[model samples]
Target: MGSDDQGNNDVGRSGFTRRGFIQIMGTGAVSASLAGAAIAARSKPVPPEKVMDAENTVKISLHVNGAQHAVLVESRWTLLYVLREAFGMTGTKEGCSRGECGACTVLIDGIPRYACMTLAVEAEGRRITTLEGLMSGEQLGPVQNAFLEEDAYQCGYCTPGQIMAVEGLLRKNPTPSLDEIRIGVSGNLCRCGAYTHIFRAAQKAADLKKR
Candidate 1:
């Protein structure tokens, strides 16, 4: 009886005893159960209340160009899109939808900001000035006049943003030096290589504001 027990405990030709094979099978079954539990947890549906409002439209009042506009806009709608589409203020060009181009520049509370990057909902309760707002009863503003006189733009695609940047700069520093002027409009890019004229126009705008 002792010899028979010893033979039963010995490793088989497959190198695994009956007890060892049973242990491995049990471990594999446990691992499979854990994996199935994890998969089931991940597949569970999220509650409706926990969902985000990414697709919903919201009504917002925007104070733009010294006027109040009550408009319905989606949460993701950009200020640039609202200005051009809803308000019909297409003067604010859309070059790079990304903020890098500065083509969609606007003034929020007298500060230059990229409208393409700014959401329409964010502009609520803030004063917004676009390229179209820089006109006084069919007459161009001082900065616009300076740009026109100096021929600051070649293609004129970047002219609106450049003018707005200069306007914001001169509001803070009425007498900015050449270097200061360069830094002021640095965010704007003129693909027409009109930096020289643009800088000259900014200087002229400073002088014009003084008069």
Candidate 2:
């Protein structure tokens, strides 16, 4: 073959020599293999001892309402599940179960929180107040009474959460304005569209708390 033809054979139309192309392809293959190896190493299942397993159970003491109880719970167990199942405090309703709906509202350290979003282990040493906690031996608390008197709830599924939110709000602000009341229980969603009654109940609750 002519020298020019031989030279043309060494370099392709793309300006890359055959050997250079081979070397680049080989380097890319090696790099891809190394990257795959790194990914595989990273994707290996974490050791059970190194990571918290969801099935692992831990014993924890929870202060609920005015009582204390010890229970074993999985790391993945939500406060809503523990309250409903362990203590049978089903008053804390599980609405959305994703923290979107306020049906599972509870007071943790006297602050309103979504029980479904709270892990059971996190409330170990915290004071948890459910819907039933807002009662005195069959006598409804002021917030509950106001809710009842104002007819705040329709289906009553979200009532517990609403009451708890109001209780927390009143504890922080005894006299919240209408807008403040709206923002206070904004997390709780009443599917019955009883927002008007709920707002009135919050105002009534504030008054009832003073008495």
Candidate 3:
């Protein structure tokens, strides 16, 4: 064993020799290095919670079915996710999530927009309507009834957007003919070849408006 200028004994439990002192010093140096590293690690500043929260929050306000909603949404979330996840309005379908399909369409102030492509922030202060909003308590809206009676949909993947688009069309031109109905619904494609039925539903809706 040996004592350094620091008055610390440099020795192990074994017999204290010159080699034992060297070994003690070497172990102390290694221990001090590890302690410094641990203190440095503890002192490093932690990242802000908001940075993590960025993936979990954004401010959004929407006018839906004549009601207003203010919500905090995830930054990467789309309008469809907000309407479905936050608002529990799931009428909008999620098909071909890349926005190639119109199944996730909804009306923003009477104009149809792809909900999948729209951001929750983009829908701020806008009147948004989903399929759930199209009907009154017990009475189906004219567009919905027309789709039902005319059997406009097959698998019904695109029905919500189709019905909303029909509502928009009827609002613009109350007496759209069969050809006009075809043109009105061209933006919505039906893989089931139900175009004829869908157009008929639109015409039926126009007729209902006349009554």
**Residue lDDT tens for model 2, 106-196:** 9987889999999888776566777776765435688877876776766778888999999999999999999999999999998889999
Residue pairs with backbone atoms closer than 3 Å in model 2 (clashes): none
By lDDT, the candidates rank as 1, 2, 3
TM-scores, one per candidate: 0.74, 0.74, 0.71
Superposed Cα deviation of residue 7, candidate 1 (Å):
99
How much lDDT does each candidate structure score? 0.75, 0.74, 0.67
Q: After superposition, how far is residue 85 of candidate 2 from its true place, in Å?
A: 0.7
lDDT (Cα, tens digit) per residue for candidate 3, span 1-211: 0123113243221212222222212222334434334433654424223332567676555666655667788767889988778776777888877777688878876677789998777666556777766655434577777776777777777888788888878878898887787777777778878888988888888877677
True lDDT of residue 132, candidate 1: 65
Candidate 3: list runs displaced more than 4 Å.
1-56
lDDT of 3: 0.67
